[model samples]
Target: MPDLKDLNSIYLIVAFVVPGLIATFVRAQFINGRIDKMTDTVLGYLVITLIYYGFSIPVISWILTFEQGLLKTALWWGLTIVGPACFGLLLGVAAQHGWLRWMAKKLGLRVVHGTPSSWDWQFANCYAARFVMVTLTDGSSIAGIFGTASFASTDPTERDIYIQEVLDVDANGIWNYRSEPSGILILAKEIRAVEFMKEL
Candidate 1:
């Protein structure tokens, strides 16, 4: 029930939307942030679409000022897609590595929608050297020193963590083990909190 213009607009929207989603995924994976939430994904796509236009418009106009004709039109359209995608990829990588995150925090851009932005990558990056206390939703807890290869997930409902040289804690909230248990795997969905251990 739509006309050619409507369909063309939909296609144009998809062109920006797909690349934006990919860029968001790339950055989220890099930072170990959950990307499966529908609201987060939809908001990311919309924001990226706006960013595409925000970046493309000025560059296209600047380029058009240098040339005029059908060739200029072709150049404008081509640059609109290619330039933004390349820039977005670089931006995403920077964000994943915590550089952009640090800058955002420094600029007071840390919280969004009443929630502080916390990435699992921050935990994964620092957990190797410290002891971790993983408390589960079922009231069971495990404490351990994680190996360097242990990892975290980007999915909130489905994350997995590995801990090596696990220490056993008694019923009274005291560690009772002088020996390590087997390596443990903790699922993020089952976990309630991860408490970092102070230096012993």
Candidate 2:
């Protein structure tokens, strides 16, 4: 006893709502801790949905002229499910490659990279260490320790300071220190600042 108007409205609602919700949920689950991933996923879904409807609508209208209820509904649902999934996958791949990092830099965000440069053996009776922080032209920052500077072969004029350890600051302002292995140089760009520590 459902009227044609109500049935049509339901179909329209389902066509829009189902795909949006699924895309949002999939993006939230797969892309964690990265803002670019989330944004790309949403944008991709929007583009794909538009493209799908653009081509499908004319064909669907013709089909509706011949076929009625259940068959048309099935076709609509099938397209809804497939379109968002494909879009989300594409966005996820793009996000993993640092596209967001480049964009963020263009927006004048601060980027920091930290590494070790030299060591003061006199300061630390047990160990001598140097640190370097490379704050890029961007806003995002990366901190890492330079376990060995001799192998780094970096130019002295680069304003690089050797640090013993790299400190990673979370969004909450908590600091976690990670040490690098000897003879290995850690390179990060778009950093804020770098600091060095000496223990006697």
Candidate 3:
């Protein structure tokens, strides 16, 4: 037979830790930034878990206290997992859409941002129908259709790109698509800058 003390400890851990891990994982998908140290990460999760439990505990108290059998088990898992998931997703969406940033700005925290870099912010807003103009370090430039096939690296360290349907610029600086090359890959090292356009 399992020790009651051991079982209580397990229950306490499950009640706190699992939901936190799930919440953090879900939140990370929307908010990107520095990787915290392990201790900091653990403390962050614990805080998130506690805050979540404070609100959730009251709502699920009856089900937890009285429900039995498979229904109880299902509800318990849902409370522990799905509840936190929804909480995290709400947080993520808020953070991603700048609701958090807007609040921070109102609070005069001017530097608060959802993405780690301007590059990320720009690429995250990239639309399939837009145009991309990439200027090279060697005084040349590449124009392309930023269509469905194009890609920009999300990795902060890897600024490379695969732009589809390469274009040529006329003397008047208008962008027109080239027929031969279907796509092109430009390494981060070669790029000096990039610009986006709604129309070529």
Compare the candidates by TM-score and give the number of the best one: 3
Candidates 1 and 3, the one with greater TM-score? 3
Q: Per-residue lDDT for 61-135 in model 2, tens only? A: 766675668877776566688656655555454443445556778998755411123322121122334433445
Q: Provide the lDDT at 27 for model 2.
A: 46
Model 3, residue 56: C-alpha shift (Å): 2.0
TM of each candidate vs. truth: 0.56, 0.33, 0.78
Q: List candidate 1 segments past 4 Å from native.
A: 1-7, 14-16, 33-46, 61-85, 90-128, 136-141, 167-182, 188-192, 198-200
Query: Among all windows of ten consecutive residues in candidate 2, which has the lowest summed lDDT?
Result: 113-122
- Total clashes, candidate 2? 29
RMSD of 1: 5.7
lDDT of 3 at 56: 84
Q: How many residue pairs clash in each candidate?
A: 0, 29, 0
lDDT of 1 by residue, 79-146 (tens): 64565557556765675455766777899887432112354545635633667888899998789775
Worst 10 residues of 1 by lDDT: 111-120
lDDT of each: 0.64, 0.47, 0.78
TM-score-based ranking = 3, 1, 2
Instruction: Give the per-residue Cα lDDT of candidate 3 at 80.
Output: 90
In model 3, which regions exceed 4 Å deviation? 1-13, 31-40, 105-111
Evaluated with lDDT, which candidate comes out highest? 3
